[model samples]
Target: MSKVYYTPWRNDLEMVDKFNKILRKSNFLDNIEKDDRIAIKLHIGEYKNFAHVHPLYIKGLVSALLEKDCEPFLTDTTTYYCGHRFSAVGMLKNAFYHGFSFANIGAPFIVADGLGDDKGFSVKVRSPLNELFVPNLFREVDKMIVFSHCKGHGLTGFGGSIKNVAMGCVTKKSKLDMHKVVKFCYNDALCDGCDACKDVCDREIPLMENGKRNLSLEKREDCMHCPACMEACSRGAIKLEELEKIAQVLPLAVEGIYKVLGKENVRSINWGANIVEYCDCMPFPGRTIGKNTGIYLSDDIVAADKAFLDDVNKSTFMIDGRPDPEIQTIEGEKIGIGKMDYERVIL
Candidate 1:
C-alpha cells in the first residue's frame, strides 16, 4: 500500500509550521533535486471564493523547495467558462485578487496556458479521449507538486488531487472534451417559464420559445457544461444526462501524470480545510459541506484522492443525495495509475 501523510489542522500552531511539517513528513521536498524547476500546480480559486488552499501554505511549500536549491512557481490553467479566470490576463488578475501575488507567496505566478488559452501540447491516452492537450509550460516543468483544495462538485461528486491534475493541467479544449459527456436537455412538461436557466447561463444558450425554454444544439454547443442551468431550475425543468461518464475522464488525468512529471517525480497534497459543497469555479461562495478534515499528502494520486473522499463521505454532506466522488479513484485504479488502498501515516 502507498503511504499517505496527514496532519490535523490545529488552531494553536502556526499554519505555516503545520504545512511545512506535513511536507517534511511526506518527504515531498526530498524528491526534488537542486535547480529543478518545480511547477506548483494549484487552483487559485475563482473571483470570490475564499475556500481555496491558503496562499500561506503555498508559501511554506515554496520556502521548503527553495531550501533544497530548487525553483518553484505557482501555476494554473485558464477556465472554459466566462469568468475572472477564463483568460490568462483575467486569471492573473483573479489570482492577485485572491492574494496569490509573488509578493505574497514568494513565488512567481504563471497561467500555464498562455495569454489567450492557446498554448498547449498534446498527449495520447487510452480513453474515449485518445489525446489531451496539456499546457505547454506544465509539460516543460521538471517536477510538479499538485496542491488541491478538497471540495464537493456537482458533476464529478468531488474535486481533489486527481481532479486537479486531470482538468487543471489540461487546456480549455481538452477540458471541454472531457466534459462533453455532460449533456443537458429541457423538460417542457416541468417548465414554469422562470427563465432561471437563461439568467445563469454564461453562453446565453437557453432561449425562451412558446412560454418555455428551449436550448438548440448550436446553442448547447457553446455550453461550458457548468451546472448553473441545472441548479437554477426551481421546477426541475432542465434534465442532465451521462453524469456517470465523468469517470471516463480520469484517464486524461492519469495520462497527464505520466506525460508531465512521471509518478515518481510528483507529490500530491489536498487541503481539506473549508470543505465546500461546490467547486472553486463558482463565482459565488458555496455552503460548507464537510468539516475540516485536515491535510493529506501522498505520491500516489489515486490513494490520496480515495483517502480524501473517504473522509468526505464520513460527513453528512452529499452531492445530489449521493456520495459520487469515488468514481475517479475506482476508474484510476482500473487504468493502472495507483491503488485505492493506502496506509495512512499521521504526523
Candidate 2:
C-alpha cells in the first residue's frame, strides 16, 4: 500500500505552515535534488475564477523546492476549450494575473504546450488511451510535482490528482481524444441532411452522404465532442453520449504520464480546500460542495486522490450528474498507477 499524508483545514497562516510541515514530515521532497529541473504542474484556473487552488499554497511549494537547490517552474498546458487560456500567450497573461508569476510564486509560469502543440511528443500506454500526446516539456524535466484542487468533476465525480494528470498533463488533441472514446452516435432516420450540423461545426465534422448527416471517419479525428451537432439538431439525429471519459481512461492517462515522467520522480498533492461541484476550467465554481477538508500528499496519485474522494463523498456525496468516485481509484489500481489500498498518516 502507498502512503498518503494528511492535515485538517486550518486558517491561512497555519495552512501554509502545515503545508511545509507535511512535506518535511513525509520526506516527499527528499527525492528532489540539487539542479533538478522540476515541472510544478498546476491548473491556474481560467478567466477571473478565484476558486482555483490558492496562490499562497503554491508560493509555499515553490519556496520549499527552491530551498533544495532544484530548478522549479510553474507549468500547465493550454486548454482545448477556446478562451483566455486557449493559447500560450493568453494563458501566461492570465496565470500571472492570478498571482502565479515569478514575483509572487517565485517561479516563471510556462505554458507546457506552446502555440502549435508541435513541441510535444507521444508515449504509449494501456488500452482506451493507447497513445497520449504529452507536451515536450516532459522531455526536459527531471521531476514533477502535481498540485491539484480536490473538487467535483462532471466526468470523474470529484477530480483530485487523477483528473489533473489525465486532462491537465497532455496536449489539446489528447484532451479531445479522451472524450472521443465514446464516439459520435448518429441516427440516419432523424437526420434530414438539413446542413444544420454542418453549418454549426467549426471543425467541419459533419458530412453529407446519401442525403444523410454522417460522422466521416476521416474528419471525425478532429471532433472536439463539443456536441455542437447534437445541440444544433432540431431532429433527434446526432448524439455524443457522455463525452467526458475521465473516470474510465483517467488511469491510463496517468499511467501514460508516468511512463514519460517516471512514477518515482513525481509526487502528487491534492489541496482539499475549496471543494466544489465543477472543475477549475469552468467560468466559476458555483458553491462549496462540501466542508473544506485539508491536504492529501503522497508519492502515489491514486492513493492521494482516493483519500480525498472518501472524505468528500461521506461529507456531501456526488452531485446529481457526476460519476461514481470509486471508478478512478479502481481503474488507477487496475492499471498500476498506484493502489487504492493506502495508509493515511495524519501530519
Candidate 2: tens digits of C-alpha lDDT, residues 1-347: 88889998887678888998887777789898899999989989878887789888888888888899999999889988667898889998889888888888888987888773644788987777788999988888899999999887654566788888888889988888787776567888888789998987767778888888766788766777764567578896876555335578988998898988899988999998888777788767767878778998999998998888767654354554346777888988987889888998998
Q: What's the CA error at residue 321 for candidate 1, in Å?
A: 5.3
Q: Which stretches of candidate 2 lie over 4 Å from their true place?
A: 183-222, 227-245, 314-317
| lDDT score, candidate 1 | 0.81
| Per-residue accuracy of model 1 over 1-347 as CA lDDT, tens digit each | 99888877675256568888777766756778999999999988888887888888888889888888988999988998788888899999988999899999899998888984674787887668888888778667998899999988777778888888888888888888888876666778999778888998888888888888876877667887778888999997776667767655865566665776687877799888888888888875578887788788898888888888777653444456424677788888888778899998988
Pairs clashing within candidate 1: none
Q: What is the lDDT of residue 46 in candidate 2?
A: 75
C-alpha displacement of 281 in model 2, angstroms? Answer: 0.8
Q: Candidate 2: lDDT over CA atoms?
A: 0.82
